[model samples]
Target: MTEHVLYGGKGGVGKTTMAAATGLASAKRGERTLVVSTDPAHSLSDSFELALDGEPSAVRENLFAVEIDPESRADRYQSIVSAIASDLRAVGISLSEDEVERLFGSGIPAGGDEAAALDVLAEYVDSGDWGRIVFDTAPTGHTLRLLELPDVLDAALETTDSVRGQLHRMATSTRSMLMGPAAYFGREGGEDELAELKARMERAREVLRDPERTAFRAVLIPERMAIAETERLVERLHEVEMPVETLVVNKVLEDVDEGCSRCRTRRDQHRKRLAEIHETFPAFEIVTVPDETGEVHGVESLERIAERLEL
Candidate 1:
């Protein structure tokens, strides 16, 4: 059974770095690990110091990385819809040219990137090709939308299937009088495809809600706004039944010089926020990463961060 780990938080909170470190740690432990970035503004490549694509590329002995390109995914999704429309036309259900233009000409739908990312994520989870998979999700709002998409899409698909079924029945009933028996068409192929898609979504939702198979880790800084947003994110995750049990507090000032008053004041503020984090999320296992002196990038820096992760 492959384990899935996801790191999500406010943007610029170091979710990508934390996710990369965890992937490195898992690979170091001899697991075949894949680190996936769902952020449109991908930084996983920067963190790993390696170029990546939609297809998984090897980072080292047991580590792989991929960045989901939302624009490309959205284009692919539009192509799929066009194919479905053609299929409908082949079955004697001709869509008006106006309808086709309206559906395809307007470009990617709102939130299409997130929807496409969810589809790809579900496929990866279902593949079970790696021992461990880690996700560097988008900012809190987008991540929440992605998590909720399975249920929303499932419902929409169900309704669409029902309407299609009704149209099929009506067409079948009227075919004899309108275009004769030669015009009759069964929607078996489309129905089968829809059923399979729904099943895939259900499996994805199950995997996400299973704590043993999936771990949702929320990352945050010590700032008041970040903490508040994190609280809301956790609450929403719980509502969706994908509860987060771990919180990663990144960039803690562990060694502020006593001579610098400004540094001391900032450190004191961090300490106060740290105490509040503990008090607020007492049930969560908190992991703190110290503020590094220089930019954290490349495999070596990720390894150092991994050591502090304690994952």
Candidate 2:
């Protein structure tokens, strides 16, 4: 079974940096690792200082990376819908070309960006090409929605039961002449495709909730707003029974000069927040990454931070 590590938090809290580092660490341990960005902004490539596209590209001996492009994913989703439309047309459903195109262009069933990103994630996990996969996710709200999407999808599929009934009525209306009987129940029709999609979505949901197969790492800075947001997120996840195994307190200030009053004040504030963090997340294993002097772009700097991940 493949192991998945997902790094998620509020935006600008170093999630991409931590994800890249963790992937690098896993690769160094001889695991074939792929670090993927689900954020529409796509910063994983910049973190490695390497060019990447929709598909995974080798970044090191055992590391690969991809920046999932939303446009590309939308196009792929459209194609799938188009195929479904064709199947419907063969069964004599009077759907115009524009109708099919309109359906394709509409947003994905549940929370467009997160749903599409999770679909891609499910594909990667099913492929089994990597021993470990690290996801650099979107901001907290979007990532949480992605985690909660399985329930939404289950409900959506249930709503589609009416559509399936309509399709069956259409089949009987046409006497099933052009469309084979096998098309009514199997892969030749839309029903089986929707069922397969649901199965894949459920599989991804299981992988995310399984502690042994997956780890959700929440990253945050030592600041009031970040801490508050993280606390809320942890509570929400707890309500859903989704486990967060680690809390990464990123960009923590270390060794501030007492002569510099500004640095000392900021350090003191960080200490208070840090104490609150320890109290708030007593069950979580906390990891801290000190604020670096320079920008942490490129593989060497990322690897340095990855060393601190202790994975």
Candidate 3:
């Protein structure tokens, strides 16, 4: 099975750095790796100091990176909906464009934009080219919302059948267009947009549920607030049946670096936190990243962190 690793946590806790380092680790092991960013704020590029866009851009010898945004996919989705509404309006249909959008948009039972973005990521996964994919995801709240979308969507669909059936039918046709011999989306034939949406949702559900192949790991600082949040995330994942497999403690101070008394005191606090992490989640692996004074960017810097991760 193809392994996928998704790194997430608090906004400023260095999750992207960990994700990128892991990608570097994969590449060093000769794995064809692609690290993509699904964070709307889009910091993967800045983390690696590499240029990125929707299409995957090569970051290192074997790693490629892309920063996907909901706005981009939402725009494409919007245009499709607009054209669809216009066609309906031309036929003297009573439905307005906003109504048409709400009809589909409201039914997007999950995190509206995140589910759409995952659809994009799933396409890349299905390409059967890369050995691994590392996802530098958004912060906890947004990531939770996105990951939980499939279940929300599934429940909503179960509750409302009358409106969902047409879209389901459309999904069948669109997938057939994309995956079938009769596919001609831009030419003599076209796909059912509703069908496309269904296929996308199904893929997200599968990805979110499959723990053996996908790992949702959290990165944290050795602070009380960070540990508490991560612990809560673990419990939330358990409640939702989405498993979190690893916890990483970043920027750990190795020893009391000669600084002000405050720095030494904080270092002592980290020592205690490490012990707490060991006690709290004994089954899970804990990886430490040293506090580096120099900025961590580029493949060289990532490689150093990868070594610490033993990745």
* TM-scores of all candidate predictions against the true structure: 0.90, 0.88, 0.81
Estimate, for each residue in 189-300, the C-alpha lDDT of model 1 and write its tens digit.
4566567667777887888898889999999999999999999999999999995899999999989889999999999999999999999999999999988777679998
Q: What ranges in model 1 sit over 4 Å off?
A: 74-80, 83-98, 104-109, 178-181, 185-189
Off by over 4 Å in 2: 83-93, 101-110, 173-188
Winner by TM-score: 1
Please give the CA lDDT of all the candidate structures: 0.83, 0.82, 0.75
RMSD per candidate (Å) reads 2.7, 3.3, 6.7
TM-score-sorted candidate list, best first: 1, 2, 3
| Candidate 2: residue 266 lDDT (0-100) | 88
Tens digits of per-residue lDDT, candidate 3, 1-311, equal 33788888988889889888998889888899999888888888887897889888888788888888565566535544544454444334558556885775733323655775677667876787888898888888888887877767556544444333444445446657667954324331113554565566677668767887788888998988999999988888777777676788998887664867988888888999999998989988788888877667777788889997653
- Is candidate 1 or 2 superior in lDDT? 1
Better of 1 and 3 by lDDT: 1
Superposed on all Cα atoms, model 2 deviates from the true structure by an RMSD in Å of: 3.3
lDDT of 3: 0.75
RMSD in Å for model 1: 2.7
Model 2: weakest 10-residue lDDT segment is 182-191
